[model samples]
Target: MKRKIRVLVAKPGLDGHDRGAKVVARSLRDAGFEVIYTGIRQTPAMIAEAALQEDVDVVGLSVLSGAHMALVPKVKEALVAQGMDDVLVLVGGIIPNEDVPALNAIGVKGIFGPGTATQEIVDFIHKELAEPAA
Candidate 1:
C-alpha cells in the first residue's frame, strides 16, 4: 500500500491569524493527507524542526504578516539545514502577485492567495507529489 502523504502546515512569523491555516490543515486532512499543524507565532526554525520530527513530505506555510519575503527564505534555509531540501514547500496567504516569481525562484512550488479553492490546493499537492523528482 502507498504511504499517505504527510504535510506540515505552519504559521511562521508574528502572524496571529490562523483561521485560514486551520482551514487548509483540515481540508488536507479530509483529502486523505496526514497533516501536522503548528499554531501561531512559530519561528522558521521551529517549523523546520517540526517538519523533521514529523517526517513530513511537505511544508505548508501560512504567512499574512507581510513578511513572506523575509520569513520564507529563512524557513527554506532552516529546512535545508535540516537536510529537508527535497520536501515540497508551499505558501498561502495575502501574497502579492509581484512576489510570486521570487517565491518560486526560492523553491516554493506552490503559492495560493486568498479565495483560492481548497480543492485546487489539494490537487496541486497530489499532482506535484505524484510526479517523480527530476
Candidate 2:
C-alpha cells in the first residue's frame, strides 16, 4: 500500500494567531493526510526540524505577521539544509498578492489566502504530490 502523505503544518515567526492553522491541520487530517501541527511562535529552524523529524511530504506554513518575505525564505533555507528540498512547501494567510510570484519563485508550491476552501487545499496537495517531479 502507498504510504499516506505526511504534512507538517506550522505557524512560523511571531504569528500568534492559530485558528487558521488548526483548521487547516484538521482539514488535512480529515482528508486522510497525516498532519503534524507545530503551534504558534515557532522559528523557521524549529519548523524545519519538525519537518525533518516527522519525515513530512509537505510543509504548510501559516504566516499572518506580515513577515512572509523574511520568514518564508529562512524556512526554505532550513529545509534545504536538512536535505528536504524535494518536499512541497505551502503558505497561507495574510500574504499580499504582489508577493505571490516571489514566493513561488522560491519553491512555495501554493499560497492560500483568507476564505480559500479547505477542499481546495486538499485537492491541491493530492494533485501536486500525485504528479511525478519534472
Task: Return the clash pairs for model 1, or none.
Answer: none
Count of backbone collisions in candidate 2 = 0
What is the C-alpha local distance difference test score of each model?
0.95, 0.95
In model 1, state the lDDT of residue 106.
Answer: 90
Candidate 1, residues 12-70: lDDT per residue as tens digits?
99969999999999999999999998899999999999999999999999999999999
Q: Give the least accurate 10-residue stretch of model 2, judged by summed lDDT.
A: 125-134
| Candidate 2: tens digits of C-alpha lDDT, residues 41-97 | 999999999999999999999999999999999999999998999999999999999
